[model samples]
Target chain A: MAPPHDEVADSRDRAWGLRVGTEADGTEARQPVMADVARLAGVSHQTVSRVLNGAPHVRPGTRARVLAAIRELDYRPNSAARALVTRRSQTLGVVSFDSTLYGPASTLDGIERAARTAGYFVSVAGLRSLDSRSVQEAVDRLRDQGVEGVAVIAPQISAVGALAKLSSAVPVVAVGAGSRSRLPMVSFDNRAGAEVATRHLLDLGHRTVHHLAGPVGWTEGRDRQDGWRQALEAGGARVSRIGGGDWSARSGYEAGRRIAHDPEVTAVFCANDHMALGLLRALREAGRAVPGEISVVGFDDIPEAAYFTPPLTTVRQDFGELGRRALELLLEEIEGVDRPRHPVRISPETVLRRSTGPARRT
Target chain B: MAPPHDEVADSRDRAWGLRVGTEADGTEARQPVMADVARLAGVSHQTVSRVLNGAPHVRPGTRARVLAAIRELDYRPNSAARALVTRRSQTLGVVSFDSTLYGPASTLDGIERAARTAGYFVSVAGLRSLDSRSVQEAVDRLRDQGVEGVAVIAPQISAVGALAKLSSAVPVVAVGAGSRSRLPMVSFDNRAGAEVATRHLLDLGHRTVHHLAGPVGWTEGRDRQDGWRQALEAGGARVSRIGGGDWSARSGYEAGRRIAHDPEVTAVFCANDHMALGLLRALREAGRAVPGEISVVGFDDIPEAAYFTPPLTTVRQDFGELGRRALELLLEEIEGVDRPRHPVRISPETVLRRSTGPARRT
Candidate 1:
């Protein structure tokens, strides 16, 4: 078979040795082939191809000259067969937002680690926005790369609709996806985590808890809000809905400042730890003492969470598990098994930090 | 031209619809080719090829049946052209360690975002340790994919040596890499951050500052220790080094408790915010009040840093900048530009939180 376009081009360049080449100049002398390397290295063409592909059982000296000849000839292996038996590009495509938010970043790291452990390459694409077009474009680009599998780190609600339009030609596992997705996914149980944080505050004897949530469109926002609501309803406590904000410490602080002004709000559950940090700042500025006059709880026990004053009482999401599971699902698809779609769900655990305490007497 | 080995297999599987057909014999039948899909869909083979390759100008109806036949035949495109034009697998390989530390995770996110923006696929390989053999094996696996470029997120001292072995084959960029690497690299300025943090306390009239460093073997640990030493020496203030710990809150707390018991230590600078938090807990337990009796400063102003009781005063590394810069460098290499080999260092800024205050009279 003739070499693919890239290998042919590379081999042609290698044949030139030091000759300049450009796309417009299509005519070029072809480089030495497997036959040429075999002739020089005193090996069969099959042996040369096997050495080029790093097939396990070659003799040591034969491997060396073949490698030297490859270095001299700059022989490039055919990628098509490599993708076949391996059933992999050894590459993972990660679709994510462009922001530097803590949760997405952590999840990306875990995904990278898991993929690396499994001996796959990782490529990342960023969605400029959560719009359908942006997501579709990202997916299209990843598909064009001949990726074996894709792990989407999209957290926006729009991602679900956009991803649904994606071709299921390859296995895709989404992280922080909406609860309703048919695609295999791995995510932290946000709703349960929110409930745990809320109950911890309520158990501290606070009459009611104020809630500051992430943007309503995010899956995390919806799930955390749901958990907080369910916890409040279960306790028969009036759920005072505070207005929404973005997932940032600055937003949390703004929301926290607003809640601090209300005399009846003794405890509050912010959607994430960053927001809680902001809320803590606002509460302090508003002359409300943490765990003394007011208690606060946060979610996603980020690395910096426990360092917050009164150490944040928050929930921890095992991002590593999410990353590992997402890769596993993608691999399963690559392996071409007709296994039933088994979506993996990881639960969040709450850590008792110093941020929550018994409600102060009026 | 024949496609690269991997692409050929992928295309073959799709063209033949290997997933859809079965054989009465134990051996499986190859999926039908584009010729079959074209025959099945009542379109020319050229039209079927165009539809499969996503040619932009195809008519909707014609595109639809061709696509339907594609779903029916599962025809896949030949990877020959892609392999030739880009000399790219259209895949990027990333190697990282297993820990879920905040900095590395966030940096990975930034790189992933950038890779997506550039229209490349990502594959990740995670290492259990930063040993030479493991890193080499990981690199070899990535090389087997014929990756055009690679990014390694190794933060340990041993990782520096491992990267040298990976330098010859691909355009490798090391993230969180030490100064010793000759390969192009991007990293945060840990030393400068520590100096600025320590100086802030000294400016507040502290005679000396105690240190809580990360594990000694890591680049971060070494840079931070050097920075602290340089600052104390530069200020002509007393310096004391405490036994180091990992970048965790528990370790910080233990170090903090030990420091708090020594009345001479009035100000402390921790390697990271998590340790600062632990230090705070230890300080409280030891009856040393924050800012009143002891002042503290930390690095990596994570979101929860502001929520730490009295809020953590720390240094903030712009991870977004780090990610963007790394991407820019990688692209430059891919574009074959002449670039300087100096370590591109990003300066971390001091975030003034409430954790540090003026020193009190003894």
Candidate 2:
């Protein structure tokens, strides 16, 4: 339930009137209306309206002039009046879980940026848990607010399942929920990224690579682990699955401790860069030189990855691109476009640095 | 200008009716209204109204029963209707710059959590630049959408200055802009945190400490540096001001490269843990062991800090608590509470880890 907004009604109402007029004395100067823009642009009011609505009939030169005048006057069409005419809020709701994590956080940032560019406001609801009830409640709350569409950053399996079970009146898109989802989804090539990282170590002459996975329930983690296992088996190399970490450096360090002590361990592939930092530290402390005694690779070439002791070789996920694409897809659905439902997979690229090298002669 | 709300007027109207009834086929079902809640609690409609309005006349047991009925029915009062009566939006706008960094990201997550708990929706607008034009435009956009109040997470000097010059109609709170601003503000004690981190090394018997600061314009960076300088001056120790980093591991590595060659440098305090991670790596590459030869401490005890090679002894700022406090203060002001105009400062604490140790015998 949204809190009442009337607490500051008096002050807010006064400010609303002042917003249109620029006079310091609170004179009624009024913001530039559509007619003012049309007059300044030397175009018909209908043409200016056409430009604003992105209609195809307006000439390019006239559109340019109208846009220039709008920018010059800092014209913002009154959203309330527009909402009344169109009966659309032009706002999108986003449901995100574990929003502090790099991937989710980056995705959320991307969504906000893209939404703004598309002339839409973003309302975000961060979930503390992945329970089905919580997901339903969040959607219901957003629905009550009358958003045009929704984007759920559902990385966890449970979250995706809950989303699939729920029905929304507006268009909905899920980010990072894998390709098998029933709803429109956008995801990075998590499986292929892990496969490339694993294969990089294999090509470096490491017989097999040890895996340090992210926490269970995350689709990305599971997909990456599957890819690693697939690559190892395809190469006929022995596969060693280490206990998974909770996508934290501490968990990576703890996992690295056990791997460092094993003489047979020659190479490792962590799910993310933070864990790779821990792995590097563990190997260094154990007196095992990186690349000389062991090779390491990580996923998600986070900003700090390049500065890791020996620099890190990892896969990069373009979260911003994902967000942009997701918004575009959601908008298409909201605008009543008859596009087919299919998952949009953004490709991931491997970033080679000093972290991975040819296995030394035993 | 808020968008029109007439597009789904028919469906929404029907939903409003169903909210009070429990008919099958899901079409007849509606959110429980106050009347329904009253009936379920075996109380008069006026009594339910009194409970909802917090009139203070209801007995404790009756209040509990009303609340329980409300909860069981998942009743949410129609915010739009309420807004019509009270002229409130029931939404809070957040203006944040650099929404991807850990501190800012964590703070955003905290704001969302706190807003949800307070039964308010959070609308976020991310600024691409700290220029006053951009800041003003973002605020105008949110304002056009009718947000009740705003929380501006302005970390840079330009951003703080921009926020200070702007006149907002809604209650506004700036976070992390230092304590000198005229607007209500909430901030973590960056200076004290840095001072404690620097003094920890000084107390460990280090002759002097090198400082790796964040990029220029950020108040956190400047405040932390000031604290480090103050601590060194108080200890009568030489302060080596190495060129600052942009709060990134790459910049930290570059700064560390210069510091590692100087044999006189015995301790270093990084403005952030990310920079500290890079510093540790640079020292390791330069063959100068941490603590064994030189000690290092960092601010912002990030989750990965403890997982650094020897773990990091750093200062921790409660970003979530800061967000919560900022929202609380903004709400008070919005509710017309006559609170004093001053910044609310949250203290920082040092987490003892293995990053710092006694100075090595020269």
Candidate 3:
């Protein structure tokens, strides 16, 4: 349906417009079509279209004239008309769950910046749950809104299954989903990051690094655990799972209280920074000096991580880069590029800080 | 324009439908209109409308028949049709800046939850800058996308001015903008929160509290500073201005390094918890014992605050409540409720933790 007349008036008032050579009565009027720009520039409609579309083979003088006409007419391309013609909305949808979390939130911020830079509007569908039904509904809603492509920040196992089952024609990119999925995905190298963190502790002369894992069902947590186990086995150190956290400080504190009681636990690796903060508190209360008696490390160098007591030695994920690469992959699919389907894995860098030190002499 | 045929087919495959009454040829067909349900139910169209709208006065038996017919026909109320008839898109647009920050991010999460609970979809236009042009463009973009109302999370001073001058017909509620503007707003009591944090430090027997202010131009920062000054003046204590932070840990650390040199500084209040974390780090590195040589406090008891070194004593702003209230006010304006123009202020409470204690006996 055509937009209401008032909406048109609102757009006219806000849009940039110029009073160029105008009507037969010598009065300036609104220019609503490409023909008006072509007429004012004394150029053919095909020339104007070529200029607008950046088509090759246009003369410099003709291109300059078309540009001048566009500016003079204050002619902004109508997205609705363009969508109708090309069957594209030039809009990307982001389906994010629990965006308040640092990982998801940072990823989303990156996606928005990248999408906007590529001249696309981002419509976010925030889901309250990671259930398959909720994921499917959110995708359907975005599709109904005419988004040409979608980026799903699906961090959970169930969400990956839902993405595989989705039948929408719109191209989809799943952020943070493991590389096992059939859909295009961009993710931080969780297992590799964890391996580096674990190796850092082993290099410090610690016998083994006790793991405080994130909750089950999260691909990140599972991958991190796998990396930690692999590092321990390769180092010929005993692998012991102290406990896990729900990626919350309270849960970390609860798990830390148990780990603090074990005299053999000299080094600990937390899945994320928030849990590391809680572990620090529990260790301090238990009279264990950070890096003096026990070395600690965490993942996701969030903004506050550097300010943690003694500063956290953690792995930093370049969420912005991850988000940008995700958009690039999604756009390639949207633009119908027949590229090979390979997941993009962004490497994480380990940041050395006061939180990790050489293990105490036996 | 009508939605393409494939979209309809996709919806048909997923939508709930069951064959019941048959046509003259004894075959069930697609039902796309309310009249089809009414015909199958042997009821008037008005009765079906009343049942769908949950309007009172429909007989129980008639309502049941209409509901059954609706189920059998898979009569999903079309949002486009409803929007055309009622001029309501059932969507709320949120204009947010720096959504990666804890306060703005939390507020946005809250608003999304509240909007979803109200059966509305949230379309977020995340601003890259708080400039008037950017603010106006975001609002215009959302309006063009057909949001029924808007919640502008305009914490910056210039954004409030932009919101005041907005000419769009859609109703707007400015969240976190100071109450000085003509538009309705919902905000955490920044002044009260700062006042309480300052008073807590002063009441701890400190001669005066040094302030780590947030950057200028943010109404939240300005109000927090005002509250801190008011508390100091009310207590008849000397006020000293330490350096300010840009609500970032790096800035806070830079400011903290400067504050650590002053021998007279016994207590300090940071604008937010992230900055407080930096302050703690600086103090520890300077060998100043927390709550022994100096006491510290902060505003915005973010989730990680309780796990900070020694746990931070801070003011808690209910960002979720603020967002929920902002949606309520915007919805009221959208529904044309005759209400006063006063802004809504959500109170903040001081959370006492290990970060603050009695000042040292100098």
Candidate 4:
């Protein structure tokens, strides 16, 4: 939404306040390509293309016409050749999905901050899907702009593979990507965080914790579920599993409601904080008392977690740390330093809110 | 945060599932700038700059020498001229701060999505503060990049003034900015959202409602307090305001605990939902049964809102909508179309959850 016209006019004084430099107009007029001038001047296409590309063999009078024609028409040179020669488009291409989800957006902020500090500009391209074709198309566009390097922030399992191919061509970094390839990568320890949450519940004397996992295709979702399963198996507790969920609070609520209504469920761990929030509501509506009958724990101690009714007990992953480390690894690679191939794991801490408690006396 | 190398490698095959792109030689030679080529060619600096810019009028011999020098040095002309002719960089600069707060991050995502759809790339510059120097420096850097326009997501009152100065030279749209200036802007009706939250509590039959606010300098903070004050005045009820907080759950928890310690506080409308979550915990700790004793309503129906132990009844703003609208307005201005200057106020919807109820009769 924009402000009214009159307000904009009034604020025009405020508007022009900080601009520091101006570009020359004469230089812009001469930017027309040789082909454009040649077409206007009635020359062969190759002749015009040669004139624009600065071929030295053009006839003297023909060169004058080409120059005059170039002046008459305004065209910008192809960005590709310019990018190839300058080696500094001062731009960094960022490939990501158009998502309202918290993780990707936060990582983007981190990437943008890191890029700015390094004095480079950012050009973002969003992916419609993690398929190879979509990834390739986006990559081609970035390459067209002649960006110095690229950063892919998609968490889909396929993205790592898509990125592995891209890494050998350009300096590429993947946020929340697994450490499978030799290409540099950075991500949160999803499995460890989930394990911590599950173990916390078990330590409180809960028999076992049920899991509501994120979509299976994402590494974070799978790792978290694995962590939950690992903890349950380590404790010799039965592992009951629900099939799937998108990373949404509503899905969590639905999953939570089902767990609450079930007689066998005594404790539950949600994949992320948003889902845990939903589950909490579902449990309440089912006439269950949190922590008293069904102890619940969540991941990603988002800002809202502490405000949750019982204050959610959840594992907190530092996304800022994830981003910083990713940038560090990428910069190191960019500077031609050889870092270890092993993935650097940053563990999340458990925030003990009032939501988790000992099992019922049944 | 990343996994072990073998795990990432295995995941890559599962995700990408195809042979990686063939590796091309990553060695691309750097191009020389006009400044460097001019020195080598022994021509006037302007002649070398002009020859590279394709400016006519250089003699055949001089032009030939310049061309030879350019080829030898692999000279690359600066591509900044796109700004002069089309007056379009096809890029929008986004200035923001590092915040996981729902409003700013959501707004950022919305803008990015909208910008991508408009065929414009987004360059984000995340600042740590909204101080005059910080805002000025950020805007300056974007201007240096020759960005056609910019969108600032800074909401601090201090930024309002700093950004007001920034809009004149460059087309800028300030999102979640203060409305003190006539500069093109997009923001939510924080006052109205607060009024609605407070009125909802008042309509629930509470004699009086207590308020918990965010930091003092933010525009949202001020607007919410104003709305709370206006609602109290309209109801002819005495206002009881307590502890101020930053927009964090921990801060909210402290404020909530303070409010819970007060026996007379029956109804509370927190400035934002995260804080409301904290209040719920404090109330529970104080042994006050929600609705049966104390009632709470929050603002901003964040994803986690519905998942609160008792679902949270709060006001929700569509960040995606706000972001899209802001971009549309900026584009309108960028394209030199006449646009109104009145700030667009998107109404926030009240989401009814389980957190609010009729006040108990004492």
Candidate 5:
């Protein structure tokens, strides 16, 4: 059952440890193995294992001796050898859109924090797209590196077949991909957020709300747009043809230019804070004062949202909670706990600020 | 040298593959090993290996049969077996400050793109602090997981002793850490960027620019403060006491509130975009018009800068380039390439927009 080439790797591993030890400790020419610690402490290998694992059977004197031996030798148990013993790499992988957009970036930071708290190493694969081929490749690459589970933070859940195939390979939890798929997912209610924004504007006495939507392809954009439309229709208001942007401030500004001169448009709900900032600028340039001449609402209360000239009223998504819950679900799946299949959805809360107000007298 | 427990893992690997194959392929209940493909194709194991590795010297017909056999049996090479053969994990690690801040997040995205292009998996370790003890712990963990190299994107370059110790364990490249350390670093010229911002305001006829600086502990903040002071001295303008923020818009707003009513402060340069944004809000609240009564400039042209009410004038750092160059340096270190010892420093550019104008005659 032995692989012929393993001898080469084994020799290389020994040489690597020795070389590192020589340079690291200066005086020490070789790394001390567990056996060395066992010998120094006059303990059996099982006793050392019990001490290392924090198992209860080791006497206080024996534990103290083993710890002293370990400190004296500065021995670090080899990761590969640990994997060989436990069949766990203690590593998780994240595949995300390779963009520095605020939402994905914050979620990633959150996931990393959660993983560290849960005692796992997190690996990441940045994909240019969430197409089937890209996802397939990214997952395969992570799996090849021995990741125990994966968290995918991209929005293109339309690539359902590929994701379905991928989950069979490893435990996976989706974040922000919407709850469309049967896979375990932790998502923010983008639709609910948009609805709340639209309703708030509507309650401010606006006849109708113009929607500045995110790019059409994003699931978040689609859900939010749906919510906006639903709220408008429910309020008996006319639905203006939606203006779209790629979630950039510039694009929002451009969309604002078109809406600013339209005397009939008194209210707007932007899909994200950056675009809302741009829209506000365009309105300002057109001599339209926020919440006076026009009322504006945005989504995702990014750190800069409150600093906008008039201060933005936007949806607050707890990305930290989303990440923590995603990790919880991923770990559960990895441990093979048979829980009922229900996607975890967090409802976003609306933050009221100066940007939204009563419509001006016509 | 054989571990006695390996038989259990080996059997589990086989069973795991079969279960996944049954679930993934439906029709195929057993996952095909390389030997199965070889047997079906009537080729030696070496021939199958050659085909899998894309090595030359197999006849076209033999290659076709091997491909057909691979397709028929749905073979996926076992990762552990592959590790035994090559002894390379093809993974690189990144240790970063666990923050959703613009700089670190963007740089991390850049590193991930570069790593993927270079055909490597990127593992991440997010530390709450870049202190000496935390770094040593993180690097040790990554080393245990068999990362070929690490890119650290945090600033406490003062942790020189611990970082110096870490290099012996693995190849590492530091990003944003000051050039003071002997370790190779990819850093933005924070001082130069600050100088450009201050000089731009000074050139606009502002006698001196009040600085709204980031927190003092950050290397970027300290360097920026130095550059601001140096620029004022060179221009023969009296340097005022600097205001400080925590790199958040809210902090900037508070600093702005203190300065908005000051007749002596006609111009202000912030250390980062978010702080500048806060400053703008505070000025607006105080009825001070941008470029009319006061002028403002900021560093780090975050995506929303251009959409500001008066589009922000700022210094732009190319975080992508910073990440890419850091990865290049790390790869060089991993490959043991002999190179000059000087660190790589990228100069940021000043992006002028509507925010800055000649100071109003006092």
Candidate 6:
């Protein structure tokens, strides 16, 4: 019953985003001592350590509260700090990108939330640049923070390339880096999502669907473009010239101004929701009726997509699942659980809305 | 004279949200050493140490590159790590709320970018909740990361109240946590922004402007409401019963639906851009024309604001400067500079666009 990528959008709308991590990777420097947890949990240091070590005779309720205190304080002890099994730092590190684009920010938030729910302090190092040197430095930074493992929310090309060669003492997982990464990673099927969106437009009687791509050098953009191209080829429709942007609403608007001019461009699939929003404005300004004259599909069912002039039809990327899976995988590796090599791909769901509809006769 | 908060938005558009911090509050756990900095900078450990200690033996160019490597790797040494002057962690800790709201997120990005540019690595601890216990725990988590200083990006009432009572060994600066907070905080004057927004509508020949406010219990929400009421009172206009939401578009749409039923309502001011967007949609659905009949204005001129069907007229909060000022304040405190007590209040500017016009004859 396990799906590589999620098959359908589930009803579990838990407001997924960043909560945080596991393991007590306490460094020689002072950190969340057992006393801190004891004070917070209204217990003694000895009792907290006893719970941490999973010793017999500790009550379940006491253990749960102690764990809660430990989690709240982010007191994960590094095993090197002590000779006993009692040592552990319930902390996980995440390497994040600079931008707050809907996809990556949500993914980071998801991982952090899952990690925190599982009793760990999530430490994030947002990279100024994704060069190999910078990525390596970030890993080093996380190591300094005493993280037991790491999750790189890297969807850019440079970051993924750097990730492939990264060597760390603890486990590391890549989220949405790309399909070709050598390290363990989890990603939603952006390609599949694009294909579905394109097919929906094609099925609406449009001869072909135009693609508004993200900027060059993005893995998500590439995957989406590939999917759109593949779907067009599969449908025996002509692959048209692709429009591009740096993935900003303004860029999308500028690109949209041009895309709106083409009378033949009756159906368009945008790379993400923000861009689609701009495209909608452009179409409206040009006096082209949406769905009536042009059918549009967008990827990433961002919260704002539903409130667009005509509610947008978009591919909903469940970052909640993606983040949880990445953290779980990292935890498995940290805790000596076997980590599967193949990347986990969550398939996006194409949501039906007024933006996409049957193409009107020219 | 320097403004307590920024008086105007600057021309510098760095696409700021979260880049991150400085100082290597490295723990006893094995971390980024001078050797690591040397490796990254392609310099020797001696040179790195010399640069760190402010020694005159190293070349200016060499010192610059070594610091770059130190920053790139987040390899700031905690003072305890070395007895000599050769210790410092170029890292700053930020305690952030979990939501990706436009205001807070932008402020965070600005801080991170400023931190990184100034040769520091930023560490963020996102809170799952804003209760006092949760806020305290977040602060404790940052302490565990070995940050020399902290910035609490707290906006909620609970978080602000907790922050007022907070005591820490490291310097702490509050960002957007409300003006009433006792802590050494920096905030944008949402009250001033709201007053200007309301005043703009009243000047446009409207009797009074109805308000769509953020959920209760938020300091920003409270401040905005206060400003709106004050502006309405000043204009001798009837202050209608306020509308509210949990700062989401859906809530705005719901509120808009109700507001749209009333023909007496000629103009409305929304708390944030996202909610305004929903209001626009609902207005259209109800056959109310933006500017043509009902003038609408919003706060937070988010990137998508301009792309809205009738490019939204709204207030723009310059988070870049706010964040930099907060970080700078924290850094000043960290470096033993005299601390200032008054909270920094940044005033937002209203950008005129197509969303607002004079009230109809009716």
Native contacts, share recovered per candidate: 0.32, 0.43, 0.30, 0.37, 0.52, 0.22
Predicted candidate 5 versus true structure: per-residue lDDT over B13-124, tens digit per residue: 4435423543433343544678889999999878998998899899999999999998887676665566544655678898887548888889999999999899888888
**Cα lDDT tens digits for candidate 6, B63-173:** 889989888875755333441132244567788885466666677778877887776767677787767788888887666555667899878888877775554345678
lDDT of 2 at A260: 91
User: How close to the true structure is residue B232 of candidate 2, measured as C-alpha lDDT?
Assistant: 97
Every candidate's DockQ is 0.23, 0.30, 0.21, 0.19, 0.39, 0.15
Interface RMSD of each: 6.6, 6.2, 8.8, 8.9, 5.7, 17.0
Return the TM-score for candidate 3, rounded to 2 decimals.
0.82
> What's each prediction's TM-score?
0.78, 0.82, 0.82, 0.76, 0.90, 0.80
Candidate 6 residues lying further than 4 Å off, grouped into runs, are A1-91, A130-137, A143-146, A168-170, B1-91, B168-170
Expressed as tens digits, the lDDT of each residue in A213-314 for candidate 1 is 888779888888999999999999999878788888878878887778888888888888888888887887888888898898888887767766667899
* Superposition TM-score, candidate 4 onto the true structure: 0.76
**TM-score of each candidate's B chain against the true B chain:** 0.81, 0.80, 0.85, 0.77, 0.88, 0.79
What would the per-residue lDDT of candidate 5 be over residues A176-232, giving only the tens digit for each residue?
887577788889999999999999999989999999998876788888999999999
**Highest DockQ model number:** 5
Stretches of candidate 3 above 4 Å error? A1-87, B1-87, B167-169
Residue-level lDDT for B90 in candidate 1:
59
Error of 2 at B253 (Å): 1.4
Clashing pairs in 3: A1-B1
Best by TM-score: 5
Per-residue lDDT for A1-362 in model 2, tens only?
Answer: 01223344454444454333345553545556788899999988778888988999788888999999999876766565565456578789999987787888888899999999998999998876877678777877787676778899878887887787654455678888876678888999899999999999999999999999988988888999989999999999998888899888878888888889788888899988888888888887889888788888999888878777678899999888988888988887676555566789988999999988998887
Model 5: which docking level applies?
Answer: acceptable
Please say which candidate is ahead in TM-score: 1 or 2.
2
**lDDT computed for candidate 2:** 0.82
Highest-lDDT candidate: 5
Q: Is the docking of candidate 4 incorrect, acceptable, medium or high quality?
A: incorrect
